[model samples]
Target: MTITIDRRIYNDSVISKALYWLSGDYLIERSLSDNNTESVTITANSATDISETELETRLMQTLNDFKLRQIVADETRDIKTILYAKAFAEDEDLSEEDIHD
Candidate 1:
């Protein structure tokens, strides 16, 4: 089965992450169009009872989930970085005030 995804709605990173999870079960190929869309083709590695419609549905869900995760990660990157630094820092000056500052 093949699906076309708009790059504006879902970036390459999100699509790649979603595809990585299914790589073991499916032989996947992707191509980019000049219009800024991605064409993904997926084939089962082995015969399965799952229908193509079901597979497409699952792939869409995974892509949406990863896109949301990517958004959250991007939005929180600065805070997350500060928290990690605080967790591993040896200096005592890294405190709540430092985070707020």
Candidate 2:
């Protein structure tokens, strides 16, 4: 159950920053399990127990704002007709089973 970054990580920056926080920069109670064991451990910066308020504050302050809405808009706008067709066909009854020969 050891925590690790997925190998197919499309966003390395996001994963790195999250890993840094999980390793404890501002000191938080985040924990990950040991492989093949139930051993408990704290991050390297575990000088004291992490407080919820402090964790929340650090988390809120470290957020990276991006043009998420704009990206979503572009994706959706380009596929409007495709989406409409899919929506129209979604209500059609179909067999759940797949038959392969």
Candidate 3:
């Protein structure tokens, strides 16, 4: 099974980051439609599919790939707080040194 998800937001920086991922090793652009509101689409094929759960597995993998990239950078720590601070901010009280996720 194959699935594609796309959304066009008003922010260019976010679009640039998402586009960088969309264009993968063998990504297909498929068909696209646009308007003054927002250009977005999804294309998928389950016709010649062999695997029983390929669709679900691949979708989960794709979502995880993006989630992994959304982690805040260490360089931005100065602008915010440490893990401890974040913990406190959220009232969790975790250590900033606990870098391993």
Model 2's lDDT to the true fold? 0.40
Best by TM-score: 1
Better of 2 and 3 by lDDT: 3
Q: Which candidate is the best by lDDT?
A: 1
lDDT of 1 by residue, 46-97 (tens): 9989899999899899999999999888877667767778787757344445
lDDT of 2 by residue, 32-57 (tens): 23332222222445455656556544
Which ten residues in a row are the worst by lDDT in model 3?
Answer: 36-45
In order, the Cα lDDT scores of the candidates are: 0.87, 0.40, 0.43
Worst lDDT run of 10 residues, candidate 2, spans 1-10
In the predicted model 1, the residue pairs found to clash are none
**Tens-place lDDT digits, model 3, residues 6-94:** 44322333434544554442333433344323233323333344353664465446555554454444345544555446656776454
The collision pairs in model 2 are none
Candidate 3 backbone collisions, by pair: none
**What is the lDDT for 76 in model 1?**
73
Count of backbone clashes, every candidate in sequence: 0, 0, 0
Clashes of 3: 0
Every candidate's CA RMSD:
2.6, 12.6, 10.3
> Which parts of model 1 are misplaced by more than 4 Å?
92-101
